[model samples]
Target: MRRNPERRAALVDAAIEVLARDGARGLTFRAVDAEAGVPAGTASNYFAKRDELFTQAGGRIYERLQPDATTLAGTREGPRDAARVTELLREIVGRISAFRTGYLALLELRLEATRRPELRDVLTERVRADVEANVAHHLESGLPGDATSVRLLYLALNWLIVERLTLPGVFSEEDVRRLVADAVERVLPAVTRPDGPGPS
Candidate 1:
């Protein structure tokens, strides 16, 4: 197969859009080529197999949906106190909210993975790596939690993201903010609280 990094990247992005708009069932090479405004069969040339296209699309969605540097710097700075952790969680929610399409595409990919064992393995590893990275980041930042805590937080945030994106008005913005605050407090209790022992 030919190797054109930029073109392949464009195809992946287009695939993400297609996945978000049309779901996995509608994701075809022809659809991707149309979405990318490239000649027919362009996506097929870049990704000969459907699974390959889906894998690349999943990776591309993660790349496009990552939090910005400002948010990362805030998380890295200072102690990971309850308030700080809440703020960080809020920032993450904001970023995910901003890139709702990419996250939606990722969610679609997760569902699609169930039907294909090879794709399932690839997606599982990708998600596992992401969780591991979050665990490491929490450790480096002195976040008030272990890998288990990080994993819980990851699952909670992902659920919230899906709910907010897919269900729209199910939860107001303030409701989500409060949910994040409560989640952080529960998962990562403050190191020291005047009242002693954090919320249960």
Candidate 2:
């Protein structure tokens, strides 16, 4: 296998696009090569097996989807209340929806995982770690939610993302945003105020 990190990353990204468009059955070395506009067999050189490519693509998609430092820092700047949580959920939807191909490809990886135990294990671990990280973040940031609330939000918001990416017409953009706020309200305790700015 080749040792060029950039080339390997490019191949994995191309594989993500192919998986999103064609699913696991259609992801071939030649297909990835064409998608990447590299020489034939280039992907095969980097990934010895199709399963290896699938695993790399799965991780690569999440890497591309993760928020940058600015986005993370912004989450901590505002009030730590239910409304702030709602805005965070909205940001989650918007961020994931913006990377349509990556999210769609992730869905494909989930389906493929059903038949491939190796792939399933990797995905399971990565997703579990992600959930734990969210829980930690919620707790540390003084967000108006417990661990369960964060987990519930994670579940609801992910399905919302799926609907937005796969069947966008089902919900208008405004409706999706509303649903995010609704989901937050459902899982989080109401943070009511006396109709004025919070006291010092």
Candidate 3:
């Protein structure tokens, strides 16, 4: 096994692209080597097995999807109201949707996880922790919505993303914006809940 961090990272990224473009079936060590433009056998030196590659790719996708300081700052400065929540959700949706290959590769990894309990456990734990963190953030940030509101948006918005990615023609960009607004309106209170952070 190799201990080259940069090389391993590049291999993982290459794996993600291969998964997105060709799915799990097409994700061979040779395929990754080819995608990375590295010599044949290079990916094998970095990844001991395909499952290792899968888990690394999943973690990398999350890394690539994370928001930066500006995006994080936007969350705190916004008004603590449903509309603000909608805007935040819209921004989040946009950010996640923008990483087309990452999301698509995630879908591929998820399918692979079904047959491999080891991969399933790793992915489930990571995703579940993420969901819990979102719920906790909603509650602590004084966001207008409750934990339930956050969960609802999580469910609806993710499906909307799937639709947008898998079938772009199904809804126009304007339609997505409207649907996001409507989801927030339906799930969150018209006025900020008394228990939540007061509107700025």
Candidate 4:
């Protein structure tokens, strides 16, 4: 019999919640079944292997990241106005404070996947897509050369936000916002440097 897609998705979301709240060691099929409000066999039926379940769980986590990522994605089609870039930068910083653990869980899953090649491959694809989307957005907006620098900016900003969450009283969300915005401003000019004088 075909399983309901919604129900299957619910189970996958539940697994991510469990993984985030309890960590990988604490995650179990039983807990996911409980969280999803379904029979234990139901989750098993949808995901016959633990790796398969974790894979779906990782996908759900990435889906949660997309909305804010799309804020960055929007700037790709054209040059981002200053206000738009600031707003996007702040939103990205805010997501770090709001979903710190979820982000950390994603990091943990990435590390765990190193020993598990299949899971690693899945996550690598998602990460590549995310970075590419952002990179494309930056490039389309007339940002030139130094793809590595732009990619590094993306990586550094994300790590900086994540680092703030791991500390207490070291920085506030506002501080992160300012820092990220400053970093973006420094990087933006280089990417959008003039090839020649053009109409502003």
Candidate 5:
């Protein structure tokens, strides 16, 4: 097959939109072609199989949904405290809010993976890599989180994101902010000075 990066990317994005709007069952090549405003059979040319399309869409969603450079820079420069952690969490919430459809599609991908062992394996590796990356970032930022703490925080934040996306208005943004602050304070170790006082 010919390699066209731009066309493949457009098809993958179209798949994301279809998955988000129509669910996995509705993610067909024709649907993607329609979503992308391309002639019929275009998506099929890029993705020969449904599994390939789903996999590419999942990967694309991860790339597209990642926090921007500014957010990462802000997190890096901010004080390494609970409040800063809360701010980081807030940034996550903001991203999820902004990309609600893409995130919803991602959740669908997770559910679809349950019955497809190959897809499950691929997704497992992706999730594991994401966790490891987050752990590294936390350590690099001087955040008080070990691997376990980072994993816990990740799970908690994911749960919150899932809940918020699934049931809008179930928790206000403020509520999520408070929950993130509490989770950060609880999961992360207290920062203490060697020759001075610690957090009260």
Candidate 6:
């Protein structure tokens, strides 16, 4: 027998809250049960194991990321003005900043994945698909279909943004944005050119 739909959702939400507040290490079924106003056994029943709970939490993050990726998919630029790529970058930095703890949870999940080949495979595929999907959206005109380069670019940008938080006082958001935009303009000149001229 299943719990009420509302209760199930409540438990899941509690799980996320626990992750966000205390990280994966603190995500005990008892903690979630209390947060969800359910009995411990109910939490156990819903998530058979700690691994299951962790996987579910990871899925929640994946669910949120899907819309962001889909919205920007298959375009050389996102919905924001190309001139405002810096602004978009800043926004991304801010959004990620708000989820620092959640990001840690994801990192923990990744380590767990290494021990579980099935989970590792699942994560690998998701990561590849995500990069490919986003790269397609962020294409510049005349860009070579170099899948390897595209993958590297995605990895580079992802790491840079992750560092933005970890590396304190490195650069302001505007500075980082300008640096990224300028680099893109230089590297992908043909695609990023204004109606005027390419990088001189």
Please tell me which predicted candidate would have the highest lDDT against the true structure: 3
lDDT of each: 0.83, 0.87, 0.87, 0.70, 0.82, 0.62
Residue range 6-74, candidate 6, lDDT tens digits: 776677777777876776678898999988887768888877677777666766666554545543443
For candidate 3, what is the lDDT? Answer: 0.87
For this target, which candidate reaches the highest TM-score against the unseen true structure? 2
* lDDT digits (tens) for residues 90-195 of candidate 5: 8887787689889889889999999888778878888888899998998777865567877888889898998888896899877888888888767754643344
Off by over 4 Å in 6: 1-6, 68-91, 139-150, 189-200
Point out the worst 10-residue segment of candidate 1 by lDDT. 191-200
Clashing pairs in 4: 76-137
List ranges where model 4 is wrong by over 4 Å. 68-84, 143-146, 189-200
TM-scores, in order shown? 0.91, 0.94, 0.93, 0.79, 0.91, 0.69
The TM-score ranking, best first, is 2, 3, 1, 5, 4, 6
Cα deviation of 119, candidate 6, in Å: 2.9
lDDT of 4 by residue, 96-145 (tens): 55776567678668877987888898899998988887667655676443
Please provide, for model 2 over 1-200, each residue's C-alpha lDDT reduced to its tens digit, 9 standing for 90 to 100: 88999999999999999999998998999999999999998988898899998899888887898899999989898887788888888988899889998999899999999999999988898899889998998888887767888889999989989988999899999999899888876675444344534311
TM-score: model 2 vs. ground truth: 0.94
Q: The CA-based lDDT of model 1 is what?
A: 0.83
Error of 1 at 106 (Å): 1.2
By lDDT: ranked, best first:
3, 2, 1, 5, 4, 6
The total number of steric clashes, by the backbone 3 Å criterion, in model 1 comes to: 0
